[model samples]
Target chain A: MQQTKQRLLTGNKALAEAIRLEMERDPNVFVMGEDVGVYGGIFGATEGLFQKFGPERVIDTPISETAFIGAAIGAAAEGMRPIVELMFVDFFGVCMDQIYNHMAKIPYMSGGRVKLPMVLMTAVGGGYSDAAQHSQTLYATFAHLPGMKVVAPSTPYDLKGMMISAIRDDNPVVFMFHKTLQGLGWMDQLDASIGHVPEEAYTVPLGKANIVREGTDITIVGIQMTVHQALEAAKRLEQQGIQAEVIDLRSLVPLDKETIIQSVKKTHRLLVVDEDYLSYGMTAEIAAIAAEHCLYDLEAPVKRIAVPDVPIPYSRPLEQFVLPNADKIFREAIQLVNE
Target chain B: MAISKDHLLWMYETMYKIRCYEDKMAEAYAEGKSPVFNIGAGPVPGEMHLATGQEPAAAGMCVHLKKEDTVTAPHRPHHHAIAKGVDLNRMTAEIFGKATGLGKGKGGHMHLFDPDVKFSCGGIVGAGIPHALGAALAAKKRGTDWVAVAFIGEGAANQGAFHESLNMAALWKLPLIVVIENNQYGISVPKTASTAVPSNDVRAAAYGIKGYYVKDNDPIDMYNVSKEAVERARTGQGPSIIEIETYRYLGHFQGDPEVYRDKNEVTLLRQKDPIIRLRNYLLNECGVTEETIAQLENKATFEVDQAYAFARESDYPKPEEALEDVFV
Candidate 1:
């Protein structure tokens, strides 16, 4: 076995390391976004890259998402692995035509002739009350669209590994990182945000779910920030004589149904926790998976805790009330385990 | 061509109204958001993009528009909306997320849609340009003099939608006017670093359309420039591009920690506030009295105050009401 050095690192640092490693290995790999160069990314995803690679490889672009994102697509088509940042996932509205119509559909439209290898990374999630415009985890929105491989890792290890895998992947990938979990000084971070990340470049393959905690009573599934919330809920549930298994669904498109189904088979219950809008969201997707395959295995009906379909209100109290929290997940888990 | 005295006074009053309204909004937006500055804690929550120093761009161009014309604005839309004659109380109520709002609290400040005044705006940078194109296309098809105006920032000019819309507008000869408000910055990146061209008006030549460039964020300059463009569009002479050099007095949004820009930049820009410049021009060049200016100022302040009071008194929509407007 190869020895790997481990050190505590935030999700942002881990991501930056992965990109730096990949760019060094591959000549085609480059980074571009609004502040990704000199600013090192507002969320620190591309931190320290500009200093190392210079402006040629790490480019700072204008606030034109359509132009640069579309340009990235063009560059990718012509044999370049471009990792473009959308700044914030909420800012996709202006350039959605290029995203949904062109970038997402080009491969299929070209009928296997053109290979568009690119990674579109963006910051998502909201706990800091960034209001409606800046604060949103539109995971389901991207996952719903075909031709895009969507991934949102909850840990630094997963972030670094998955980012490496994404940079090398030939297909288009949408990598989303929760701003709060990036371990930035300005934002509040959970203990789970930082973890022992390996120094060597290793890839955590896409379309796999990580069982963060093992339990027997019920299975709790979550992604990004909600994964930590689920873990917290599981810990609290353990004191009540309930064993709650926590599954981190790092990939959204190639959803790891087998792991979730197996967990439900052992636990006999399922609860989906999400930060995205409730209706037609990840919760519904996970719940549907259980209903489809493990319906008979589940002891009780599946439960879901998520932000109600409101466009995240600006008032703190209202936003808190709508958003899914550890307490909400715990309450739902307790009731599900009881039943 | 000389601007009429009545038109000059109208522009001044409108500029003053926009300034007063923005001042009131800034004050109200700070309530419950202090010490720590939690963005969602305030009364007028969400992203607030105040057009504090952009009154000249709005008032100058909008002074020529009639009731039938459509005006599409970018995220920082209050100045354009006010200039286009949107109801102040309803607009305020909308920003406050009250049931009596423009969209019954469904659309916030950035997503304001006041069809009564043929005005609408969205949070997206260059998203409104195509909408203005469609409106202008409709006017041309209907054989009407109703031109559509799309007010976008300097940053938005770099968007693919802006370029596409310009090409389509020129090719079809639609009665459209695209105003590029060169606010020197897109959040933090300056125009010099972002834009490839020294002047955006030069881009109009590529589309074979008339181009007008306004300097120093001057209201009268903007008015003089837009006058010929407006007449050209109204007479079915296709579209025109008007690029005005302007400055943003506030941050991109409320609560934005603007570390990217020099702190002293705003103070230097404020030294040449467009409203004050227009007021001085009226006083010195046009022989306008101080009492008249004071009356307009008082009127604008009173109207803005009444709107704020109305917004404060209005009730918020029911929590379940969020589901109502998604489909409609």
Candidate 2:
């Protein structure tokens, strides 16, 4: 295999690059959805794909979510691995019946008779002024589905690795990508870190949570943009001699419980930060699971720093007020360890 | 055109079975013997949607398909599931949320999966359309002489997936028969308002395929129309969408008041009830004696009764095993 290197780009662009790579590797792979080709995806996640792959492969579809998703299902059942993009996570209301009830459950429902190898990629999280109709951090809702693996990444490395893993995964997987990660500018740093990945086709294994920063005082769990906030918060706390271990839970459904539990056991305290609401969200679910499993190892009660339960307002200050940032996560972490 | 005596007798028999089975469910539900939220020892908290007035759609369509063929169903699916040769005892136990039911009591009324009997559930509205395509693809690939029927309602036709699935089924030359049971409603929403088009199958030319229509008041007409579509599909003529214009006589769910429509409309459609029409056909065309038909009805009723008895004797699932069958 030859070595392939590329210039630095945005996180969304990097993902678009990865999608192109996967398509190049296998003829069976196709990207289908609205505006994926000529429109270059809703946010340019699929720029330059139509010319590279053409309509037969990088096809654009009508505004029919279920039909296109269903076509993806039929294609997968007939042996093609189709990567279909649902424009926004919130548009999943009409498509939920197909994704949640059938796509997620059919493989198991058929007793392994059908292997649905499909990717339901979507743009999730907040910060964009798409209003309530466009923006809602809904990872928790899909995470509740049994047969689907929920992938939430906060960096380019995680994005590349998780996308490869998701594309290679046999079951139906929802890759929730946020608009915030493109700010990291980590694509250029890819070669500096993991070096260039092998040109030959491969897959990153599922269910492995990475410890982005290691410490011994308190364990911090963050997802997507929250991971970035946690890192900044950890840096600020390190000055005060407080070591916070950051665990990036890349996948949510087949959640890496052991990694989080083991990290908590080491730190004796835990703080969860998320962009979703405080009640019944991933933060709460993570806290509950940890409390039930690692209650005795805790020196202090687990804490969750989340956006208050409300619709994300459009104004910048109000949005900041509703979102959890470095100051909030830092304040929460310091309180848990200091108290 | 009225149904023949032979087909009319079969429809009457099927409608009788559906009625008997539903009555049994109502009794079970009333006696605290239902699944969901009650003793759940007898109550499983899951809502069950009974297919009462939708008998003609199931009976008429199933008439065209052989025992070896397939039918995909929706949430309101008990009639289709049973009509496809799924055991009543297992189905009853499922409705009661017992361990012995199909899907091991995981997918109550909406999901009645039977791979062996050629009946699988897409469960979600408009979702099963693709599974039908995939199965039809498999049948075509394996060179098997069978047609896959994707049974959906007027409401499901409004769904984008319905159009997408039909387009692909038409495009790939797959042997899939898409039967649209225009039950006039999807839950509380009426079809006339929900759908942008007057008809669903009429859009078949967009996918480069032929569309069909049937005013399915009589089971015989439904069977005949379905027969042509089934024959076309089995012969590798690609897919055909047969829109059966009918109405669901009951509430969308077990407790729907159907406040969405006028009662006068219901009364008008009921004048040509499939069961009565079939009975009339049997008397005029089949030249069969009333005693034999009565015996068949009695047998079906007895079978449904035994199914209830078997389901009642079945045990509840252990709490520890609650999460089983979620995966294969």
Candidate 3:
């Protein structure tokens, strides 16, 4: 009989462990960002890395996103695989040039002569009432741009694996982790946030979706924290006699449209749950994909449960109201199944 | 300051080569200009930001650099690309949108990358500054003495990336030299109108790094200043800013009507051309013979002609090539 060994870990811990493994394996790998060294990252995603890697490998940079991020691009061009952290995805405004113009466009611009093996990691999602600027999941924005592979891993197992894959990949990868799903000590997290992560270094290939729960009646596609919400909704829908298949879209750019279309073909119903804004987002793109390729497979008009087109509010009630949750996913799934 | 005769000749040859290549490009561009001005139909399609007058800075600074030293050039980058030892045949082919171009015809003129010489350029203003810093940081981390230079315009000095890069380079003590080719204009907007400070070099004080200013267009002076900055960076003295006040003889881009500057400004600036000044200095001070100068000029013209011929003979990339370089 084969033996399976796994350790329970939070999303943040798993990410750090994966980075530590890569640093140990490759001397070219280094970490640089605001509060990444001594402060252990604003959300503890980089905790214990500085002590283990030392200040040389685990560098603390000034709050200059453009400089540090662009530096990561240059370093990547010169064969160093740098994991740069943008404290928040919302702060892309200050350094979008480095991200889109250089990091994303260099390989294309260089005509395959250069490869950018860099990871731009940032914190996403907003359940803790961190206002408009602090709380946003803008994976769609990065995914929309060409030359960047955007990944949002939901579980500890997937996060660790995807991170290793991102580091090993030659293309520039944008790794976005939801704040609530990180399972930090201070932040309130769901039991689903902790998962069985293997100690060994492994990779979950990008652009592949994981079918978390298999069902028949409906297909629900979600990413990052929404995947957990969809799972919870799937359990609730099971109680209501509506079987919902949940898909965790691990990577956004190389979107797993095959799995989504296949699931929709089987279930005949589709509901996309996302924490990003409603319009021009991942939800809309998924809906469009279903309409474009698998229109007949969709039994009813594809339903989307996403944050309304509004900035995340500061108030707890308003924040919760705007964010997509299990109740929202469950309701949407039911309506899709019934219709 | 006494300069070697061979070094002066080399600088002059490089500058002359740039002038000849740009002159031919302008002529070719004019001949290819459609009555309706179709950018794609021309021999050299798309916007061309020619470095007509800023050749000295690139030649001077690049002369002091090795193949291992990296250079990140801005939009008007042909001069720097040539000076940094980019293959002239491929560069011209790239400008002509040929399959054998530096970027396989994908990166037009502005986005050239020659990894062999660690040279790259882009169209975005101030974007290359931080990239050069990153290159410098890589060299520093690897314990190499190779330095990285960022060739930016005075207009780019106002960009947030510039300040941020300068500060970071100083803090980390990375081997970086930021050379600002203050050519008096950013497209149509003059430097005096856009910048609050009198000179771009003065901004170096804000970052707590050394700054050097060259008021004239002499390539020797540029070489001297850049040598100091490059040596400082290679010796672990951190980053420094060197601002060279110069002028562009041509409009920002091809067919720019150039309604911004005084009509006589370019004419007057051409009289003080660095290439001419260097020829005179080499002849009088460095004892470089007129015959040697003539030979060098002829050689540059022949090389430029050869590059043009090579580009003209090259074939455009296949339509399917557009999808090739988007990833590794």
Query: Judged by TM-score, which candidate is best?
Result: 3
Write candidate 2's Cα lDDT for A1-339 as tens digits.
Answer: 996574445666667777888888777677888899987787666778898888767877767787677656755665568888999888998677778767888665553555678889998877656566676778788887788888887665666767877887788888888865644342223222222333334455667788999999999998877887898899999998999999988888788899999998899999998888888899998899789989999999899988788887877778878888889988988899987
lDDT of each: 0.86, 0.76, 0.91
Better of 1 and 3 by DockQ: 3
Give the alpha carbon lDDT tens digit for every residue of A1-339 in model 1. 997666999989999999999999998888978899988999999999999999778977667676567656645654578899999999999888767765665454332334568899999988778889989999999999887889999999999999999988888899999898999988885788899998899999999999999999999999988889888888899899898899999999778999999999999899999999999999999999899998999899999998888898888898889888899999999888888
Residue B302 miss distance in model 3 (angstroms): 2.1
Q: Which pairs of residues collide in candidate 2?
A: A67-B161, B35-B44, B35-B45, B36-B43, B36-B44, B36-B45, B36-B46, B37-B45, B40-B43
lDDT (C-alpha) at residue B167 in model 1: 76
TM-score of the second chain in candidate 2: 0.90
Which lDDT tens digits does candidate 2 get at residues B127-229?
A: 8887777567556645777888888887877676777777767766888878788787778777778887777778677777767777755577777777778
Instruction: Give candidate 3's error at residue B144 in angstroms.
Output: 0.5
Misplaced by over 4 Å in model 1 are: A1-5, B1-159, B162-328
- In candidate 2, position A225 carries an lDDT of 76
Best candidate according to DockQ: 3
Per residue, candidate 3 scores C-alpha lDDT tens digits across A108-166 of: 87789989999999999898888999999987889999999999999889989999999
- Taking all chains together, the TM-score of candidate 1 against the true structure is 0.54
What is the overall TM-score of model 2 with all chains considered together?
0.75
